[model samples]
Target: MPSTLPSASPGTLQLQPDAGAVHLRVAGDWTLAHYRHLRQAVERARAPLAADSEIDLSALGALDTAGAGLLAELIGPARLAQVGRWAPGLPAERLALLGTVAQALDQPPAELPRAGWGLADLLAHIGRSVQNLWRQQKQLLGFIGLTLQTLAVTLPRPWRWRVTSLAAHLEATGLNAVPIVALLTFLVGAVVAFLGATVLAEFGASVYTVNLVGFAFLREFGVLLAAILLAGRSASAFAAQIGSMKAQEEIDAIRTLGLSPVELLVLPRVLAMLIALPALTFVGMLCGLAGGLVVCALTLDISPLMYLTILQRDIALSHFLVGLGKAPVFAFVIAVIGCLEGFKVGGSAQSVGEHTTSSVVQSIFMVILLDAIAAMFFMEMGW
Candidate 1:
């Protein structure tokens, strides 16, 4: 038929069919301007084309890449090759463009293989997690070793000490933390005393509340509370401070200037914590005892004089020493973990925040774990 397909643009497609062959007469400004009509016409005519069909582009006008692509898609590589064998009427430029489009379309689309929800996937996930944990532990051990080496190298050199930095870190980690540590220990001591008095009053042993508070605070509560608080506060602060510096490339600058970051940044914080934690532990012990004293006076009706008498008679000096002795170890571990996490930070704000959180978690875990191990050792040793 000579009839043009219905359209709103200058593009037109006329189909003429004989017994053995079909002819597609394309006459249009087959550019982006008529792309919609051209696309619709191609879709409508696609089903009716015979295996022996010819595309007559002799009447085609104003072709563009988009139109050529559409035409290539409609003809397909096999049918276009068939047309080339018989018709040979397409212009050199149009034929080349169509050939290029055909070659591009000949490529197979890439697709990712779908993972099956099987035991293999579950095992793989667990394997990856375990691997990550082992890697992290290895890195942590290496860092601890490096820190110890640096400390050994620097300790004998009096002039190498960063006294100013150490003093500043002590003020920040120790002095600044005193109030909270004291208050928390005081509150916990009061709670313990109250619980002790309430339970012991039934047995006419309410007066023993002071001894309970003294023993617990002196041997465990004071140092443990201070260590946990510092894990949350000072450890996080160390990570954030150093992590920010790392993100800003100041760590690189230090390296450029031939200053060891571990000596300048880590040693000061470690020394400060070693000095500060014991002092804080001592303050926490006193405040906790004072809280117990207040609770005993108010609720148990035990006078301050009687409370001191009982504490002095029952709680030995060795108990205080045990608690104080754990402080430096906890402090060193906290400082090292915090500084290590900070140094691991990548160059981003998100990385700084992540490492800061990691520092707090690792510090707290190490402190609690070490305390438990120490407790077991002391118990077995009958100390």
Candidate 2:
């Protein structure tokens, strides 16, 4: 008899080969561990074996499904040329064990599924943005309502502070703007006169230069230039002032002190712009006309009286009224946008500077856009 097989425990390795068979024994609580070792040993032994090979597990005392399946896998490749057998074996159970391990090894890896966004999700996002914008619009309307109420109450008061402040703002926005406005207006008038004289002098119609300059400045250039000037000056000033207050938490402090920032700070500025812009536009128009008059008298020898006569004959009251009418609306728009942006300023000096610059740029763009729309409407109305 072969040397009496020694009692072995789980994970013990034993290899025995006879003339025609290999008897690999796995003993005691046989598991996948025993199966793997046994399979590896057989593979090593098979390299030198004939095409025929045999595996016998006759003395296996206890074996798990895992161990049983690994044994089947070792036998599978040699099934045609060799025989596979188990002692004290249950065939059906062994088959089931092999199937479980095969299925587990063949299965794909687990993964998380992806969720996709569709049109409905996009629509929901847009709806949310619109709702937020609607709330802001309501808040702006409320500010306007409160302003109207305050103005109603304040107008009846015997205080001269309002008028005095208006006068000061008028000087600041108007008087201070005079030199640059005059300079630019003069240049513009000179250019217009040059272009008009160049073209009209060909036909001995140089006298028409006065009419072109006068009517153009009175009707459009004066108001447009005035609006652009205030957009740069007052709009930026308002944004910077409010932005600084916001950065410093001064607006909050005013609220804490039972004061209305709108009344104390914002309203005065708004009123100032409203009063100042019209006066500035009026001054700008006069300066522009005077400029054209100088160019005409100096270069074209057109008399001042003749230029005034043409202005009276060609420029209508409706043109003057339309230009003046746009001033207050432009003022209101610049004031509201500048203050709103300032109120939104965060606690950074950079944010204050950014919003101040943005207020001026955005107000100027809006002023031009609104002017274009107004021009279309007035044209449609045959103004």
Candidate 3:
């Protein structure tokens, strides 16, 4: 029996110096089995070749992408492209593979031009931001229309009402929230009275502090404070709750069953909030007036009767009506925004958390914006 002699390593490279030019005789199973050895072999044999250097693939063996890539790197891209002329004995498919890899490696990558903070860049950024905001607002308006349509369809049929869910949400949104809304407005009312008394004392009109507190609370603070609180609490809760359901694909299941998610999930919450906010606002106004009365009695030596007398004389019924009137609008916007963000949730806890935060921010911002516009309108009307 003849000895194996280790059979020349599957991949082989031989460098020949010919007439001051180079001829590379390559041979072997250059597939990935010998990838490491082939790489090292190519690295060591990668000497600078004359422009006219030639490669001989006549003795080459089996090839693959990994092996062909190595061959392309070793032979130089310039010579690799014209392989048909240099190695006619090379298989066409292998020739095509080598040519493809060579072409790919030879070209420089294309890239976007880097931009600086110049006027053009600034304008472009502003344009993009405006476009995004417009798109978002359009979507919100469309969702509002959809919710109203769902409400219209669901309203005539009392059979479609989710009485239990509405009552539960009302308990949470209105009854459970009463203590905080009351306490917050009460404290603010007392502070306003103190400030008014301090400022009016110089004019011997400390009694006017009663009127001041009533006007501020009745006209602005009571409703504004409650809406802000709910925007933070209820809006975020709504987003998180529905977002979780969405992430679990429950909304999709409801749709698959030929039921409307907007009608089922959104209407109960919206109606509940609409009914709850005005009631909360009224509660806020009473607590605020009570707080002011306490402050006037203790600090200004004014009795509760006198404070009430002044409030009756100076604070018009129109002011209270104006404040209470804003609540339903605020409530509807908050609920709609929260539910919209929930519907937008992707399938992840991170998405739920993110949409919850976005809902709160959007609800509060809309509340403030609407409040300002309402204030201006009422002021102009002398309401």
Winner by lDDT: 3
lDDT of 1 by residue, 98-202 (tens): 677777777788898777777888899899999998998898889889989999999999999999999999999999998999999999999999999999999
Residue-level lDDT of model 3, residues 178-287, one tens digit each, is 99999999999999889999999999999889888988889899999999999998989889989999999999999999999998899988998999889989989999
Give lDDT per model, in order.
0.88, 0.72, 0.89
CA RMSD of all predictions: 6.1, 14.9, 4.7
lDDT of 2 by residue, 64-169 (tens): 7666555445544234122224333535564455556656555678997547878988898899999987986676567667776766776677562456666676
lDDT for model 1 comes to 0.88
Worst ten-residue run, lDDT, model 3?
2-11
**Candidate number achieving the greatest TM-score relative to the actual structure:** 3
Each model's TM-score, in the order given? 0.80, 0.61, 0.84
The parts of candidate 2 lying over 4 Å away from their true place are 1-146, 158-168
User: What's the alpha carbon RMSD for model 1?
Assistant: 6.1
- Give candidate 3's TM-score: 0.84
Off by over 4 Å in 3: 1-11, 17-22, 27-70, 76-107, 110-115
